[model samples]
Structures are given as structure tokens and as C-alpha cells.
Target: MKAFFRGLVRFLLKYYWLVILLTLASAGFSYPRMIHLFKTISTDPIDLLPQDYPSVQTLLKIRDKLKPKKSFGVVLESSDAEAIQRALYDLKARFERLPEVGRALVTKPGYAFFDKHKLLYLELEDLKEIRERVRRKIQQEKLGPLYISFDDEGDKELDFQDLEDKYRKRYGGDQTGSEFYVSPNGRIYAIYVESKKPNLNMAEERAFQDEIRKTAEGVDLKSYAPDMKLYFGGSTRVMEYRALVHDL
Candidate 1:
């Protein structure tokens, strides 16, 4: 039994190191390829959302890249009521003025993203009259779940739930359908709207310039630009989605 035990220990000691070395060698061989795969997976969203969207810099190039279908996103926000109203008017006017703008719509203000520097979030629900007006638009156009809407404020507006309740009672529950994000501070809110065209070469930077201008009409405004999640979800999710697409 002593001899057997000694042999067993010696065999285990000798084979254990060999097993470990093989495991490490295997991992080393796969690690570089795994890292390369990870990097490629991570960079796919940058493909879906070209880096130069807000500017018309890549418009002509992108128009060529997309032969028949071209889509673009517009995100805007305002702290000033007059600016917001002006923004609405400007957007409506621009939609009418631009012959190329086939799909014209606004997002729900409540479904927006704001910066983390904001101090207060006002309750911004439609007034009874305003709700009636929106209702009229919906009924008239038969726009059911078709429209995506947002407000000047995102979820943080609910921080003042009582005030929001008052606004809800005064206005109505369905503010807008568009969904968006609000920063931790009350300084910024973001809402996304989209446009489609057959060929928008050098996309009209002026397309929604009026709307953006309207949002800041006669008010002190700060700009932080915008970010969007159209192809999928977050950065991690995009990697997973790309892997799935690649696998298929």
C-alpha cells in the first residue's frame, strides 16, 4: 500500500504540471484570436451609426453607400418654453417647406434624455385643450401606435410626481410616443426623430435647422449634440447582436 501510494503521488505530481502547462499553452494560442474577435465585435455599432451623422460632412458619401434607402436621426432639446414652442412651429414649417422630407414627425417629450446638470424638472403634460388638439390629430390621421413621441424632460420629470399628476389631470396620460434618455443633471434632454429619402446626398443640414433654431428661440440655449441607439441596444448588446448576425 505504501509503495502504491508513493507511485500514485509521483504520477499525479508529474501529470498535474503537464496538464497545467497544456492548459496555459491552449489559452495562449486562443487568447489573441479571442481578443481580435472581441475588438471586431465591439466596433460594429460604429458601423451602423456612422461617426459623422450630425454634420452633412458624410452626406454625399453615405448617400452613395446606401443606394435606395437613406435614414437619418435628429435629436433636440430645450429648457425654455418659448423655445420649445418655437421649435414645434419651426419643425412644422420645415416639414411643410422641405419637399424632400417624406416622413415628418416629432418624438414624445417625456421620452427624452437630459443632462445631469439640470436643477428642476417641470411637469410638461398637454393641457386639456392641448390634449384635445393632439387627440384630434390622432383621430384625424388614424395614427395609432405609429408615432413615437417624447417630452423636453425624460423620466426625471417624474421626480416631481405630484406636479406631474396635476399636469396629467390637466393634460392627459399619453404625452408622446417617442422614447429618450435624460441625464442625471436637469441640464439636458434628448429626443430623436427620423427622416427617410431615396437619395439625400449631402443631406440637407438645413433640413431640421429651423426646428433646432425654434427650440432655442429667444432663449439662452446650450448645445451638447446627440447620441442614438437605432440598430440595437447598448454597446454590449451590439457586440452580441453582431456575433449573432455573423454566426447566421
Candidate 2:
């Protein structure tokens, strides 16, 4: 090993200039190639994993074959119930007519079915209270006929306004109508918008959402509902919704 090192040192000393020139020439030749490789190198973390790994294969399958269909919501909000309802229906119809929209569902179907079966959903305590109210109403009717009063100052007859106030107090007065699409407070409404385009990539999905926003802007929302605000909802905007609310 000592002899080999001595011989190598002598050789390097004899051709040191040639060795330096060769080294410079090699570096000059390889510099551009190295830069190109660096520029084209994959930065994706998934690309670092071996293709044969189970997790990598699963992720690739999800990215290529099992991509989920994207959908979003268009939210309409206002203090005026009538205006909001009218605008919601109009907007829903317009969205449905768009070529990109697969479907725009607003009001839920089967109102009669839910109305008929709503009693089953009431809690035991609530049902008991309702039964008591019914009993009291029945007793009042029965006793009213027997105790006929000659004076006008007797118990006043129940009128529409009285019944309205009674029920309005029993239930919440904030609700706009009996529709399930409107929020409980009657200030917010949502239209579910599904995409018609198949296998939308990220860029295509963003374009679709932009188209929806444009369609909404084209409509004369102020004419339909005063002080009404439109917003985007669903998976895409959910994270940013809080920021939007703060801005509003």
C-alpha cells in the first residue's frame, strides 16, 4: 500500500496540470446536465416512495382510479323570508339550466311523508305536553256550551290572530315557512349543486366553481332579495368560509 501511494503521488506530480485540465473539462461538461436534472427532479413526497409499497400503491390507485366526484353548494342569505325564497327558486332554476350542472336540489322532497310521520319524532316529554294541550282544548270546548254567558264580557272567542300568536310562540317565530331547505332562523338557504362533467381534474373543478360564481353574479340578486348575500359552501370553500364570515 505504501509503495502504491508513492507511485500514485509521482504520477499525479508528473501530470498535475493535465489532471487539473481534465477535472475542469469534466466539470464544465457535467454542469449543464446537473442543472437540468435538478430542475426536472420530482418534489412530490409520494414520488420518493417505492412503487411496490402497499401504501404507495393505494395512494396511486386513489389518485388515478378512485378519484371522488366533486360537488358544492350555493348559499343564499337574507332577512326577508319571501324575498329569499323567491330568489332561491329563481337561482336554482338558472343553475339547473347550466350545462355544467348535473342537478341543483333546493327544497327536499316528500314533505307530506315527513309531515305525517313527524309525531313519531317528538320526544316523550314533548308528546306528553302536546297531549295535555289537546285535553285542555277539548275540555274548554265541552264547558263552553254548558256555561253559556248572557254578558258580552264573558270569555272572548278565539280568533285567527290569537291562534297565530299562540303557535308562533310555541314554535319558533324565526322560521320563514314549513320548507326544510330554509335554515331554522330563516336567514340562510342552500342549493346543492352537483357537477355534470365527468372526472374533473383540479383545474376543471376550479373552473366549474368559477362558472357558478359568474352565473350568480349575472343574476339581479338585489332585485329578487334586498340585502341578500350569496356564498359558496361545501368541501372546497369550507376551510375558507370562516375567513369569509369574518370579512363580512
Which residue runs does candidate 1 get wrong by more than 4 Å?
1-10, 42-173, 176-248
Candidate that would win on TM-score: 2
lDDT of model 1, residue 76 = 43
Candidate 2: 10-residue stretch with minimal lDDT: 236-245
Angstrom error at residue 20, model 2: 29
Residue range 160-244, candidate 2, lDDT tens digits = 4544455556666634236546777778888777788755644466677878889887888799766999888745433343344
**Model 2 segments beyond 4 Å from truth?**
1-69, 109-112, 124-129, 145-180, 197-199, 237-248
Error of 2 at 112 (Å): 4.7
What lDDT does each candidate get? 0.44, 0.71
lDDT of candidate 1 at residue 158, scale 0 to 100:
23
Top lDDT model: 2
Q: Candidate 1 has what TM-score?
A: 0.25
